[model samples]
Target: MDEIYECPQCNQKITVPSEIDRAAQLELAELVHMGRRIDAIAVIIAKYKLGLLDSKIMMAHITAQKDTCVRCGNKLLEDGVTNCASCSALNLNWQ
Candidate 1:
């Protein structure tokens, strides 16, 4: 459900959409509480900001032309790198 509220200072009505992945926040919180080291936080943030990262990799996978990172599941976006910037996967293709 979406959240509707009014601003305090400006008194303007604001509408905030709920998260697309409902349990993602809770799961992330749980990981933090469990003292788990998350190496893909930047990747998650990138997915939120730049969505093409996923689509591009998925497209490559579907087409079976490009190599995708084993760890991050994302193809090479940056040049001269054998590993994924997201999860730091060395092998790009399936093993």
Candidate 2:
């Protein structure tokens, strides 16, 4: 079932799919890093059914583990490979 959520940023009601287990964790982190905290929290809340505080905590944990592949969440090497050697995902320099 889809759940209706209020956007913490825009205050707009959003319908979130219940099945978001496959949603990229790195995507959420990127959102937070890009100053889209509300969008990232919304996804975390919907995906985990957690309250706002917990969602923020989850986002912190996800973002803290930096240097990961955005697509597969694999740990990225310090090497100068622009692309993730493991998943071929673009190694975005979030720093």
The lDDT leader among the candidates is 2
Cα lDDT tens digits, model 1, 1-95, are 74444323233333322452445443433433344424224433444442444323322222122345534466656432244556554331221
For every model shown, what is its TM-score relative to the native structure?
Answer: 0.24, 0.41
TM-score of 1: 0.24
Model 1: per-residue Cα lDDT at residue 37: 25
Q: Where is model 1 poorest over a 10-residue stretch in terms of lDDT?
A: 56-65
**For model 2, the run of ten residues with the poorest summed lDDT:** 7-16
Clashing pairs in 1: none
lDDT of each: 0.36, 0.53
